[model samples]
Target: MLRSGAGHPDAGQSEASTSRQLSPEEEAQRLYATLNEYLLLEHKAQPRLCLPNESENGEVTTGARDGAAHVLRCLKVWFDLPADVLINAISLFDRFLTKMKVRPCHVPCITVSCMNIALEQYAADTDTKRSISVEELVSISQSACTAGDVIRMSRVIVDKLSLVTGCRTSTVLDWLRLLRAMLRLHADQCAIVLPPSCQEEELVQLLEIVCCDAACVNTRTSELALVLLYYKLEQQLAESLAAAEESGTIPEHAYYLYDFARQLQLHCHMCDTTLAHARARVRHVLSRYERCEARRDQRQRLVWRLSERTLKVLRPTDRLTSLLPTIEEQHFAVDATPTRTRSGSESSENEETSDWPRSPVLPVYCDN
Candidate 1:
């Protein structure tokens, strides 16, 4: 929710000073270089492994991962932690798990420990106090891991990962921040508010899905983030175009969004050769997204059909009767002339009425 020049007291002044130091183009170039360096470092730090090797005995399994992911998601919702923190924690956990063998029994302790480390790192970055308590972390775990257990695990994780306490590694979040800054900078150039900040939560949600897939385990974080952003922007653009077509008018900011999407696509294609394995993983993520959407749509359609049938059944039969004319009423109205005969002729009149004007009765038979 924090904007570049909002919330913080000196944000505007700092941004102004920073802008004075470099042009937008130069700033973008610098960010690109920094992100590229981070990507290289990430690749060097952990190379991709084959899937069979990754799923060896003592390694984490799909079921364990799903359980851990569910716990993390619950913690995020319960504690109101930033998406960035949860993502960082997951990243760190996965990296550590890749190096060390972890049993299902040890997952909860390890998960909470990684989250604690991520919280510390994030707090250090933003110069904010740690908000979560040991009790809260322990309560979120599936197993009864005490604060002492979490502390010991944290230490082991830090030492094994060689993680510096105050410093955080460059992650997908960093890439997202850079992308937002770039879009904001360009939007300023065009005198528009084309910030992609609104999509941050969506991007994080997509990343969560991608992270769970086994194919994405070995994919580079930056590539995953970029591909996610690429698909997200494409979806947005498609929706915008449909709306514009209906309205017969397009917003000026639409062009800027489209341009940014194109840039994202170009970045993906340009980096395709270097991150060749990532393309398959990205495709897998997209397939998962599509399947999720399809299922959601299918569920909605089923509900709609059920509701429609219920409405039909609940409709007033009297109203339908009033709308439709019956055969007896039609025959009486058509052939019932005034009878001035005596009461003795009433029986014969009734007998004649039965055979009189059978044409109206034909409609009842046709209706049946």
Candidate 2:
């Protein structure tokens, strides 16, 4: 169980205020130190959590990990959780699964339980509404587990990991926030103002991609964020250069953006000496994104075709047969197609018929 005060609602707010009081250099140093500590702890935990070389139950398969990632993505979209919550939940889920043996039947419940724990810890300060309830989670997962099952699994996780619920993880979002603050405070030094384009939605999407990629698992969160920011800066610089070439004149702001990109490159080199690998990872991420975008239409068509073909072949007793209606059917049936009238002469009759009750009902008076 999470200890009292471990996830106090005000802790992040208070920490942010304290960070704001510090100089940019001091803040950077503090964040680097904190990140280092987290890296060290994670290194120590990794050995204990790794799957055995030869286990009776078998090793954790790639398919399982991919499935988990898929579930995390779906949950994030369905609940509209912030990047922090989703990242933290993924962290917890990965850590727990690495340490324990979970069967396919149990993965959905475990995934939901991790999200439930993360929501309890991190969602309090966000403007988003309360996280989805266990019932909703179960429905979303299409799992056999009831609400009580999820609660119980959560308890087991808490006890097994000795997890301090709400204890902050050094997630990519934390690193991004620190980087943003540092850049904002040292704007004079960087000689650039971060455009709104560089900050919110795009960065969130990048973080989501990085978090799900297996290649990035060993990378430090701060380093990963640094690499991502560097890529964005590089992109901005490239655009500026292209504009400058086309216009035959470089804008003053373009110089600042170039300087910022150079600074980012230097910082990234300092943070990770293996620039080749980091660049490769970034390229891989970009390629993956391109592929996904290119395949979007094709994949949608494939899914629709598969759904139709598979539905036709499914037997009444098939497990998926029960899921079809629950998964895709709407709760309420309504005919959305517009009703056509023969002419103006029939308008009055149509109105009269529409006013009639569709079903008989007993009326009762209620006190106001």
Highest lDDT among the candidates is held by which one?
1
TM-score of every model?
A: 0.63, 0.65
Residues 136-233 of candidate 1: C-alpha lDDT, one tens digit per residue: 78886655789999999999999988887555566666666555555666667788765354356666676766765656766666666666655665
- What is the TM-score (0 to 1) of candidate 2? 0.65
Residue 2 of model 2, lDDT score: 19
In model 1, what lDDT does residue 219 have? 66
What is the alpha-carbon lDDT for the whole of candidate 1? 0.65
lDDT of each: 0.65, 0.64
Candidate 2 lDDT tens digits, 1-368: 21232222233336768656655566556545543454444442231234333435755655566567668888888877767778777777777886788876677788889888878767544435664787888888786789999999999987876766345545556656556544544555566677655776787788788767666655655566667766776787778889889989876775565465457556544444565577678779778988998988876343333353454465222222111223565454475655565665566767645544443232445899
Superposed Cα deviation of residue 72, candidate 1 (Å): 1.4
Clashing pairs in 2: none
- Native-to-model Cα distance after best TM-score fit, residue 331 in candidate 1, in Å: 71
Off by over 4 Å in 1: 1-26, 44-58, 190-198, 240-270, 273-368
RMSD to native, candidate 2: 14.6
